[model samples]
Target: MLYKIFAAALAAAFTLLLLPGCKDQAKPSETAEVIYHVCQRSFYDSNGDFNGDLNGLREKLDYLQDLGVTSILLLPLYESVYHHNYFASDFKKIDPEFGTTDDYLALVKDIHSRGMKLYMDMETQYVTQEHIWYKDSYNNPKSKYSNYILYDDSAQTKPSTIVFELNSLKGYDGVEHKITTVNLKNKDVLEYNYELFKYFADPNNDGNFDDGVDGFRLDHAMDTLDLKPRLTGLFKAFWSPLLTRLKQVNPKLNFVAEQADWSSLGIDYLTKANVDRVFNFRLAFAIREFDRDKIMAMADSSFSATPAGKQQVVFIENHDMPRFAQVVKKNAGKEKVGAALNILIGGVPSIYYGQEIGMVNGDKPDNVYGPTDANGIPLREAFEWYSGETGKGMSVWYKDTGPWWTDRNMKPNDGISYEEQKGNKNSLWNFYKTVIALRKNNQAIGLGQYQTLPNSNKQVVSFLRYTHQQAVMVLVNLSATAQKAEVYLSASKVPVNRLGSLMSNKSASAKDRRVTIELPGYGVEVFDVK
Candidate 1:
């Protein structure tokens, strides 16, 4: 009887081990710690020629790492007719002003050696008149590249029906240029773009991703590709196929789409285009106005819409949008509130350069309109490294004499430079650093599940981030007056010892499974729960 009982106990233990293996597996989570979006030309100047370059960025790796950045998203670097580097004249070469191919390769190697990834921006939807394909195909019916670009036959005979007309480049004047859309259906065009993407994904072709960019940001990504009705569904037909081919060459390659429209938030790109990520513009816009309800609702909606494997790129400001500092009138409290929401929210967080120091765009002329307006120039000013006008890492590329540089934004003793904020504990820059450190150090804030918590105060926004091993509670006061609120976590009881303030502008206390915190106007608090 004893021998039989021993055999039965062993069998039961073996069966229990097998049961765990049979259960359904959880989906894998995305792993992007933090992405810093940089406009290279305006970031830093290594040559002191006033233009920021790849070598300039290469020199700042330590500075970036100190700020808890794990990835760098550079704006377009391809040879382009414009300063923004969007209208590419050659996809294979780096812009001459930026640097040579060797410079870019060295930068990539340096970034990877420090355990960080690089992503380049690419917009292949349109081409300037200076592009080789456009130059070769222009009004030349017999040319091999004639079918590569869309053209109107009536434009050849009737000047009034000309589809090709001169237009001013956005953010600059006295520089009118003609542009045409590429024909995505054309086999040659498709093949050319494919090769361009593959080249950047592995420039050396040695299968070492560190030698080249890890991914590409598909600018102006859309389904139709153009305004014409016939162009609809090109993303499904073109992008999906191109992405598949690129992945086969380098399975680790990733793509983030700049969805054409920001009002609607969905996973259509991930589901239909098979892309990896999309910008959460709705959340970004909501955060700008400090709308607590809208921000919480949008955050929850974005989390639900994105499937388990895909991710959303979250940000409060970028090159195209108004600076967060400018929008909030440079209020310290408001800036801190925005920073908390950006770093603590679910999904990957990307910080626009200069945002950490509370940089604001200079006042603009009143008559300007659209992104092309001259007023947009101040939004892309040089980095203020010192309290003075000129110093190390300062790139006054547009100072004193450019179409967009009528007035300088940085003044002496303004206390908005890195030198000023680096030592000040209460500076906006330090707040960003501290919050980012918390996000990086805590796994729950970066990769765990997100849920909006219930609160009676309209001015307070509370949420929970948790995984099996960790849980975090975040509360924010959106108004400009001191506020008090209680966050009830009845569903998940708080452990006595683990309940404490991680980072906050005010004091907080825990009692009877509830967290009661007092926040000054535009204040924020992050708590670690059991």
Candidate 2:
């Protein structure tokens, strides 16, 4: 009897081990950690092409990694003709000019292996005129997508008078817009868009997109049209559902809207749409203006404005805009301060491809692309990946590279580059690197409570970041003159041993009742206290 009982007990244990209820189950929860942006390919390449590409970018990973970049926010890699790949022809393949599909896959796999994430820029606005869908829709009148092609309804009215000009509102800047606008009310087309998202999001097509890419930077996210209230409704119908599906597959998936203005509208839409983050175009615009204190004030105000859980994706430049140097022209000093602010302040800071090198568009004549506007301002320039003198490391995109959209080549900004900045202990590059390191190393800096330090001078701005055990003071001098400030910490547990200055690795000192510090023109100082 004892032997029989032992046999039954063992069998029962084995049965329970194979049963669904007894299996180890994963707790379902959705939360993603913060990721800083290492924006890739916002420049002209050296391989004789006007647009930047994959191999050129692969060469710069080490430089980016040295900057303590944890993730890469790549501009659209899909095949397109424009300098910015907003019109995607094929989502499954990388542009042959950029590199092969294998190359892109390898890049993503290698990046992931190294514990870094890659976010692809997605342009859902228009597809190439030659895309299969466009070809099919144009050829097959009976097909479901036939109605997707939007045509001027001049023939609809009883009088049939052409009151509204179709020519004026037909295309994207009149540049061969062929992507048919499908009526979102149509269930079949809505299903196709969802399927497209599923296909791209899926690394393996096992009915669901479980192993797809990490995130998406939705291109032209705000320019939805052809219907009332444009994307706010359609996105909620399509993207919101897809986001929920994607989160189930990978909880770390992130969705970032691009160039979306009207924050209130965007916030309200995205809040219900359940997007993870919204790009802060306002912050970028403010940064361009170099309204220093106003930038901080806006930052504080905007953070308060967003939904309680939503975060902002902040950037200086992306592929579409002119380089950041254009934003702070002849004010390299202010540019540094802007960088410091973006790095230290809340939100994910995105560094454009050429911004770190301080590359500005330089003069190039006979260039279809002209650097100077009617007002004599520099346009987006070719990326100066190296010193002007050519060598083996010269980018292949530049060999036949004509002038860029900005009609210029990358010129040195204050003689700064990643190579130079990495070496200099007090360089702006180092300042950014250190601040990123601090933010990553200290939870207080990343998730702590924020309070703006009182500043009497309008040109000087300061803020305090604190958590239970740590506190940091960030001060920026917005003007071209040195400024003195007295800072007081209400908390009695003041930090000692001076956690040190971020810009210069100089020893930091805060004694007695207050701390007095002097800031250089367009300078920034950080005190990381205990």
Candidate 3:
């Protein structure tokens, strides 16, 4: 761990106190969780079946626990023809390739036993050709399931396309399958979807969640249904009604909406659609930019925009985006800085698998694989579990099947995998552990409200996460060279005791309660003042 804290006598001089108070205290209902987002298909493999399954994830609970993650945000677990599990063929049925109902229930129980939560991604918007809705009503308006799907054509033969007018996609198996968006406008369709989700949240209706998932990630959530005139204001009609009902069953059930527009803050989904959380995509983009002004502006706006009891899920990468490592060109300092922003911020932190060891996208520099394959195949490659590329529990579902495997990201001796860096204290993996531990152990960071502080340096961004009883100050240097940051403390409720730090050099002088400290390029300094 790169963390060292030396507590000194505060009687001499004050050095760690930071900016003052926020008028509104944070709502602590669903805060303090470090979520580890997993594409299970690319994570652990327990059955030697080449595909990462529910049991495979259950087997790695200890690993995740050791990594300090409190929850697992799994990709869509419903039956989908798409490798990434987006276009589901069946919402009620578990994908046979992943496991069965019993496997899912067992995974849920194991997760609960560890005091951990599992959230499954659900994309009820679209369905593949094999889906019961699509199969039963694709070309028949007279079919009983006809209103279950939306069709653009008057004959009801042509189902509405999703995202870019494309109705077919070549999946991980290199097979093209047709897809269509579901009709949420229909009362029956909405009822069916709600029942499907409720069953997963409480399978037995015994009021026990051990046999069910803790929550659901609404993928590509939209109130307007891709700007369709007929589906406008679905938040009040479709989402709020459904989510309100789900919450009645399990008040602790977490719902996060992946808003269709990544550029927006998804605040509507939080307040209108009634989700507990939404991805802080704008902050994620700003972090990757590595500019102080952009990062500060976006981070401040993101945190401030959310309503009470709602939080932004801060993350650097998801299945749809490029890995942060590649975005930073594999720069170690930049990667560490990104880690700091993602974990130390006020919002609930989320970390993608393999991010701890700095895994980049599959280094495929070709266009042989079509558009669908090119988008996420590189970003969602199998987790490099061993020091070398080949090993047991290494999910090689796409190993010998695609050209993407030929030019892979998993290279022997690259020090990117967990096995390669587990023993090295200075490794990225250890750095992530240190930061995660810092967040988990500190009340100010884990459950505190975000408050921006005034700083003298342009290259450095300063802020505080605080509750009534605790406060933690974070000063980050966003430049490429070491810079001096003179920070000022105001009216906030800061501790009156000695200063302790995660800073490498604890040298600083306080005058007027402003401490000047030198931070290396992309260096982050964290202080627990309360």
Candidate 4:
């Protein structure tokens, strides 16, 4: 009778284990991560504010999450007289137009709560005339505030040396190979810059918010010329000590520089300065040649270009340039082909605002340059922030004031509004979304080592990404004609997963270490190698 009672109890426990509400039997795996880009000012209210507040950004977090984005990079938010917010007027204030300091803090808190990372674009090289340091320096160059500027001669331009006007110095007759200036040995300027650094480093001075930011995107760092390498050295010195202080608060902070060019000097600068990443301009310039083989070769050459792999930021356009749509309108297909190449090439891809919607410049000068309307605005005319009737008053980025680029404007409903393409599954928006999503879903593409396929056809470029556990081969058709791809694997019989193709739904099979597949024009295909 006791044995029968014990068996009954055991059977009851077994039944409970098989119940529908039991624990999940599946496990999670550690894989690669992804990041996305969007300008904060791209979203706004109906008041023609031309500023995007954190409150508005919070509402769109779902949109970003749906797109498989893990992080977002924001432009400068500090107070400024200009629209770009680069010429900081006050580092402490949150540009009244954007919102309040409390709002910014709340935004940061919310971002972390959502399990996303937020990076602030730090542009501290220049300040508006209204800055306290500028005002105080102009009033008394010998005062403590005067330490903010490094003066070369103090003779031609008395109070302080203006960086922009350095071209006007004597012997700089507009044709000399180089110009002379005071060595960055200016103790005054060094102390002042360090003080400015301290603000972001420890805004509250309680040593509580030193690492309040996740990463920094340095602006115009290379453009600053010092006769004695003083400026460069000073910048390098700032990083080690400054980063040390920041890491003390948050160890995951990232440091990046916007040097534009990937030269020996630029790479050396980042390495010596202890920066985590440097903008990859070399790749940007090389991709425009419209040769898939060449483009793939460039990616292979730069595998070890710097210390940062997968961490380097790959960008086609930023706030400083016209949307990539405007750039490759004549060769949109080629650029789109390049876009795929960027994804498979590795590194974190950064898309400028309006890239997916095909936003182009209606204003003259095509690229981002030329004049502006009094307030030093970067854009011209009003932009269609969203699509359909929903986006009617969602943005005031261009309507409130004249564009800094006077004759140019981004017209409303010009075939590139968010509404126009959101429903189209075949749209560029979908393409970008899928590519990013694929990166997230695949381990070989995301974290595996990259290897360029040998004997790449001129019109079709192929490469391989492999890890001990898995391998993926990518082949892209660069032209509009249907091209043939011969995929080879080190081992026998692999599964080929065709991506972004309209021709068919079948994935080709490999036999004898080789698989031949038809590739659609300007599309890519990925194969799973076993």
| Candidate 2 stretches greater than 4 Å from native | 1-52, 153-185, 206-211, 223-232, 262-265, 362-382, 393-407, 411-416, 419-422, 488-516
**Cα lDDT of model 1 by residue, 404-438, tens digit:** 56465777788888889999999999989998998
Model 2 RMSD in Å is 14.0
How large is the C-alpha RMSD of every model relative to the true structure? 11.6, 14.0, 7.5, 14.6
**What's the count of clashing pairs in each model shown?**
2, 16, 2, 4
Clashing pairs in 4: 363-408, 371-404, 372-404, 387-419
Q: Give the per-residue lDDT of model 2 (tens digit) for 340-456.
A: 766666666677655765656543222222211111113323445544423334432333332242333444444545545567776666766776777767654565545565555
Measured with C-alpha atoms, the lDDT of residue 474 in candidate 2 is 83
C-alpha local distance difference test of each model: 0.76, 0.55, 0.79, 0.55
Which regions of candidate 1 deviate over 4 angstroms? 1-32, 154-173, 365-375, 490-498, 504-513
Q: For candidate 3, which ten residues in a row score worst on lDDT?
A: 1-10
- Among these predicted structures, which one has the highest TM-score? 3
Query: Model 2 Cα displacement at 365 (Å)?
Result: 15
Error of 4 at 6 (Å): 85
TM-score of each: 0.89, 0.76, 0.92, 0.78
Ordered by TM-score, highest first, the candidates read: 3, 1, 4, 2
Q: lDDT tens string, model 4, 496-529?
A: 3432322235466656556676777776776665
